[model samples]
Target: MSAFESIPHFDDSRAAAGQQARVEDTRIAAQQFRQHMLNGPKVRYFESFDLITVPYPVRYGLRNAFSRERFVEYMHIQNRLFVVQFDTPDGLKTLLVSPSDHERNIETPFFRRLQDRTAAWLTKLIIKRQSSVPQILERIGLRPEDVDYITYDHLHTQDVRRWLGTDKTPGLLPNATLLVHWREWESAKDLNPYQADWYCPGGIAGIPESKVIGFDGSIMLGDGVALMHTPGHTEGNHSIVVHTDEGLWVTSENGVSVDAYAPLLSTASGVADYAKMIGTEVIINGNTLENAVDQYISMVQEATVAGPSRRDPRFPNVFPSSEMTPFWMFPGTRPAFYVGHARHGTLQRP
Candidate 1:
């Protein structure tokens, strides 16, 4: 069966054709999907892990703004790994999102080597990993082998050989399978010049074909967890959508922070002002400009699906995989709000 046929997607054909039409259709379909998910089960357990903190460009953070010089040269972003487990008809399923290998990520040709060298030099000073994935799993009464599936918003700087194993070495998650979008899986292998800088060299090599599962559009893994194709940052970029007691939450790297998703409600020094001046609702991640229009629509789709935050309704229930955090060293780049970490339900023990 085709990947799209493996899992059904919400019907967007109900609405007319156009940019606004797509947004409206997605909103309606996502609402129905969210209700169906809520009727099912909440995630068996949900937790976040702080992987590493790195610098990003100001121009990309807030795009098409007149006052780009108002903020610092670079903004600090804290990357996170999410462990989501839920019940399936077959059994329990554990899914990992954004499990980045920080040490090997330096191979990314950021800014054509200038930023890569800068990140390398600053590694000891700032880019410290809070904890390794294995350590976190052990502390939580789990093992790497327990992971059933591994995924990411996009491949970008990701190298999955360590997780799934290569011919020369054994993998940490011996039982894990990589769930990737067909477009993204293809993009990683044949990267163009515009896409090469953000990707780690030879990132997806030496993995057995049986260890990878490719799909298209949206697919519901089990009860409360679903993967939605929110392309734009990359051709195959997607977001993790989960339903919980607090409501619905979507995770992706489309935006760096809550402010980027809800700029009108943002209290950050200049974010709200920029949005008002530009008359735009969403502030994109802006690093990749290949399919900007698609990215904008995708961001809107995410914000619409996620709805509002429980703690603060002013913001959308969206958690950026690489969220912007406050740092003393980086002034004027502090996030207006931070989710810190999202922990929900109880972790099931083997």
Candidate 2:
């Protein structure tokens, strides 16, 4: 059986209709109340283990509207980001999840003086033409005063200052760690042009290399939850996996969206080179490891270059096939699913 067959088909229309028809159920209200205490007040959040449905505005072309669906559709499939408050025993931690480094405006004087002109130039350009991070926060119903931690899957502009330890926000958590991919923290500046500010003074001082956690394949965070390295999008791309009484549910960060992945081959190929190198060195260690590594790399390169024309034979009936399909299919279509058991582990309602 393929990965696609192993998962259930998420009915978007049924869900949309159900949400549309939902009366103010007292159960929902009670659950929201509990979530409010857990996540904290002034928390306006959205979650999608699948595709993110909110249409956040993007800059460029006539398509640059501040609509959610438009943004979702534009990205090809749903990519989720959350404006949430992560509450711990110590206190409430407010964070904007998954803020892209290349998607924020950076006007700091320190960044303007960077030595790497190419990266610096690109940073400025991305900032000039990108969506405003503050605006995104507002759209997601988050208030500046309510924010404490800006957690990110990878280094994005909003998370950069925190990562670099140069953020001047008053009463900000002094010891809050900027969780990021260890590989990106080590080599992103050279590989990704958007990371120029990360290497600068204001940026560099705050983000010490010591704060990073380099785990093989996955790492456990908070309770029993784990973050798995799924790779493919960027070298260190990962998905958040929560093991609840409901079984195992994985949040496809930049991995394959549920809708897209439903039809096996519709899944976008991840980074072939990294996958091969890591898989060979780690997962597939054996006598034929060398050949397996070479074959894996070659297969990834071929699939990548072949684009949509290359289809995995397992599931051939999927439509709108293309290797380079955009991230979201429709804005707000990829709502995050809360997977948990009905009896023991329930998804905390918002």
The clash numbers for all candidates, in the given order, read 0, 25
The true-versus-predicted C-alpha distance at residue 171 of model 1, in Å, is 1.0
> What local lDDT score does residue 257 receive in model 2, on the 0 to 100 scale?
27
Residue 261 lDDT in model 2? 24
- For each candidate, what is the lDDT? 0.80, 0.32
Give the number of the best model, judged by TM-score: 1
Every model: Cα RMSD to truth: 2.4, 16.5
Per-residue lDDT tens digits for candidate 2, residues 168-277, read 43223344444556664555545333334333323333454444345443443433233444333335544443323322333433322222222121222222232343
Model 1 regions more than 4 Å off: 1-17, 66-71, 111-123
Q: Work out the TM-score per prediction.
A: 0.92, 0.39
